[model samples]
Target: MEDNKVDSKKKRLNIVSAIIYIPMFLGMIQFFFDENYRNDGLGWLLLLTFWVIRNIDQAIRDWWDKKQKSVLFDLLLAAVVLVFLIIRGMEYFSS
Candidate 1:
């Protein structure tokens, strides 16, 4: 019974991650191609929606892993975001 519970939890997390991460990842890519972000609102809406879904999915996974309070994961996630932002900033400056 305990083993089944763990397996089920893992399966659910995988399914949820797929449902959230796939679209969120694509939305992030779309932001780069979107010029509407300059004047229109749809791009911003998409960004906000996808970001929320992505973070929610991460939170769910973290909870399932019993690491909801872990600082290491938060720090690593922050580092990745910081690096991505730095890289994007450099690209913008170069262009």
Candidate 2:
């Protein structure tokens, strides 16, 4: 029973992660190809906001489970993503 519960929880988390990531992936693709979308910050902002909100639970769980190593990795990943998003936003708004 305990194993079943753990398996189910993992499956649920996987589904949730997919749900959150797939749209972001699509949005990034669109932003790359669509000139109008690239010039608008709202879409990027919405995607970034949704990503953080959706992944916060997983991020916290990862931090709690692995302590310092996972925290460092998470922070690094976040910094990269944030930098990319900020750069894109700046490019969009500056033009």
Candidate 3:
């Protein structure tokens, strides 16, 4: 049935998202234990960027499934991520 198809798609999406999250989680653990990442602010910033991007993707998917999407919330998330990327880029270039 169509319902089964939709459920399967959702399950697949969740599986894929979990797979993507694993690397980010491992990276954070590595970042914490690694002295080099501690010394380099850029590394920390890059890790944060990846985390934000992953969350943004999830948010977009969630909004897509809803009948009434909140444009303001999505736009705010985009803006914040943009500002974060800009700051991280500046830090990367400065260093």
Candidate 4:
């Protein structure tokens, strides 16, 4: 039914939002408690994964929506990509 299709689309959008928001929120918490956690690598890894998720979501949106080429979307995608790249560079240098 048409309703089913609409529900499916909403579900997909919710999933994409969660993928970007959840880990980032958790990572922000873990970052603030670095001393207690005592593992900077783990925190960084979580944050990096968060960035990757956002980037992937942005890519999906770009492909699915014709108007996804907005400046805000571009900035978000670029920022996420840059964060992940920095994380990769840090991991490479650290190990």
| Candidate of highest TM-score | 3
The regions of model 1 sitting more than 4 angstroms off are 34-41, 71-95
Error of 1 at 67 (Å): 2.9
Which is the better candidate, 1 or 4, if ranked by TM-score? 4
Q: Write the per-residue lDDT of candidate 4 for residues 1-95, one digit (tens) a residue.
A: 98788668868887879876976778767775867654565666666666766666666665555555663575577676777768776875687
Q: Write down the TM-score of every candidate.
A: 0.47, 0.52, 0.69, 0.52
| Candidate 2 global CA lDDT score | 0.67
Candidate 2, residues 1-95: lDDT per residue as tens digits? 98788668778878887897788777766765676854346666657655554546557667645576776666667666777778877876777
Deviation in Å, model 4, residue 82 alpha carbon: 9.2
lDDT ranking from best to worst?
Answer: 3, 4, 2, 1
Tell me each candidate's RMSD, in Å, in order: 7.4, 4.6, 2.8, 4.4
Ranking by TM-score: 3, 2, 4, 1
Give candidate 2 misplaced runs (Cα > 4 Å): 37-68, 75-95
Candidate 3, lDDT over the whole model: 0.70
What's the CA error at residue 6 for candidate 2, in Å? Answer: 1.5
lDDT of 1 by residue, 1-95 (tens): 99899889889878977887788667666775776654223344455555555555576667667885754565456556656655655655565
lDDT computed for candidate 4: 0.68
Clashes of each: 0, 0, 0, 0
Clash pairs of candidate 4?
none
Clashing pairs in 3: none
Report the C-alpha displacement of residue 59, candidate 4, in angstroms: 1.4
The number of residue pairs in model 3 that clash at the backbone is 0
